[model samples]
Target chain A: MEFTVQDKGHYTEVAANGRLNMVAAPKLRKVVDEVVNGGGKRIVVNLADTSFMDSSGLGALIGCLKLARQSGGDLRIAAVQPQVTMVLELTSMNRVLTPHATAGEAFGND
Target chain B: MTDILARRTLEEPAAEQAIEDLHVLLEQLWLDAAFVPAPDQMAFTTAVIEAASNVVQHGVPTEGATLLLGVELTVAVERLRAVISEIGAAPLDPVPDLAGPSDLPGPDDDALLEDYDESGRGLSMIRALVTTVTVEREGDTNVWVLSRDSGQG
Candidate 1:
């Protein structure tokens, strides 16, 4: 998966385009780590183009969430695809990494 | 014997690239077996990928042997099945627990994430997605068979 990290003013948007499987898991960690180290908190991973994700990808998301929280900020996911949504729901991780309809709405209520 | 509506197979070095290749093969299978329901396609595809990924990530090579990922996917009139082989690998030190859904972690996401094992999650997802899943040592390979009942109109 190719990740594009953009500074969206209030939050940094990391858009992943491609399958988010084991092949892309470590890359995600690197991108999120850079964002957190770059002083960009309030992160949002835009999964609009991510067609598939397995356990490895989910684990990466969880780790990134923890990193963001540890840095005194937060990370959220938005625009989840059908398959990705299914994995999240099956593993019950959706409760922690709730999906938003759009990136803008991820932190809208916060 | 049931008539196979579609079939795809692959053998590659057990690595990250094999997972991506398997995804492509799955897409081709779905196209050929377009009659299969979307839910079944989704669930079976997820199970196959999870099983293949486990081999790529966890299968240990035997002495002087290189590990390879082998996948055989088939779609019949009323079922979807995959035989994933961890070729040239040693037997699992501790055989995996192929228990049921009760093995899944509870709804506490915080605690779940704190001590989550992706390998374990992958196994659980495979079990939950397919109607049946089993692993056994076949010669130098650890064979995983996953079957999901489908095509019931």
Candidate 2:
């Protein structure tokens, strides 16, 4: 899996490209941690290319969310694929890390 | 006997790499059996990955034995199935609870989300995706048989 963090002025967009499974879960946390620690508070995880995400991946996202919140910011997700969406809903995490329609829109209203 | 339409089998040391490799095998099996719908393919793939990940993450190897991840994926006209085994592993001390929902906070229950169970979500997900799932101990292996009905109207 590949991860790219781009500063979009309003919020940092962290794009995850590939399966976000057990193997790639920790990598995601590391990327998001870097964003949060590097003065990028408002973050949007772009999952447009992430085809799959198991529980491990979900946990990583939740962990990132907490880290962001504790720092007086928030983490959001956008462009979730079908499989990833199913996981979010099935695990009932959709409410916590809501999926925005697009990365550009994640922080648009804030 | 049921004639298998398409099948893929993989066996390796139950490690992180094995999960990645088995995902590739799943894609290959779907390519060979294109008759399965996209939704079925996605759901089945997720379930299989979760089960296999469970073995790698939680399965304990017996004394002086190496845990191996063994997977057998089979696709037929009306079904998609996989037998994921934890080879040379110790028996599950407290077998997984596949009957009811495990301890996952509701989507809107943000307060309880802080206490979410790490391992429970995967098993719950497998239960939600497959038509039927069963796990048992045979000799030294813990086998997970997962089947999903495909192309059902």
Candidate 3:
């Protein structure tokens, strides 16, 4: 998986592409921690380019959400594809993380 | 020829795509077997995928290790049986005990999620989806055997 991070002062956005399975889960966790540790707690993860995801990937996202929340901010997701969304919904994470249609919407800037 | 598909000594990194390929292969086998509603086939597929993922993540060497995955199919009058085997190092103890929905991390807890982060929940998911999950040891190699019956449906 390839991840690119964008920091815009108040919030951070992580754009991820490729499969988010066991091999990539740890890397994603590290990214989430980096964002929180850098004091960029409000996070928007853009999954527009992610093609596949599994339960481990979901777990990582949930962990990130927990971290962001603990730090007095929130983590939101945007532009998730159908397949990834299916896993999230089946696992009932959609209700917890609350995906938005766009990054700007998740950031409440639009 | 009776339907049979075999992939032997499958390396760890190749397991994920191999699982996808096995799905297709099992579908073709179903067609040849002339049976519908083969729950065992689906269970076998899920179990093998989970086993392969486990081997990839835990059993093989982090740098370079080889694991063997073999699948064989047999069709009888009222049953379709698949045998899946993997040879590798024994997985870590306390194999994931998957928590039910009620046991999930609460909306407020972050520590529990982090504590179990590296464990093998995939294997637990597989066990939940299948009828039987077993492990055996032969010399230094560990073998996982998984089976499911059509009656499970």
Top candidate by lDDT: 1
| Poorly placed runs, candidate 3 (over 4 Å) | A8-10, B1-9, B12-50, B60-84, B91-120, B127-153
Q: Candidate 3, residues B1-153: lDDT per residue as tens digits?
A: 434333223332335566555545655666665453544554454445556656555664323446655555555544445455454444436544433332333253244344444234455455555555666656545556655555522
Error of 1 at A96 (Å): 0.2
lDDT of 1 by residue, B1-153 (tens): 898878999999999889999999999989899999988998998989889888888889999999999999998988898999999999998998886453565547678778777888898899899988889998999999999999572
True contacts kept of 1: 0.70
Comparing 1 with 2 on DockQ, the higher-scoring candidate is: 1
State the displacement of the C-alpha of residue A35, model 3, in Å, after optimal TM-score superposition. 2.2
Where model 2 places Cα greater than 4 Å from the true spot, the runs are B101-107
Pairs that clash in candidate 3: none
The C-alpha TM-scores of every prediction are: 0.97, 0.95, 0.61
- Local accuracy of candidate 2 as per-residue lDDT tens digits, B55-149: 99998999999999999999988889999999999999898777775455454466646876668778878898899999999999999999999
Each candidate's fnat: 0.70, 0.70, 0.08
For candidate 3, the docking band is incorrect
Q: Give DockQ per model, in order.
A: 0.76, 0.69, 0.17
Better of 1 and 3 by DockQ: 1
Clashing pairs in 2: none
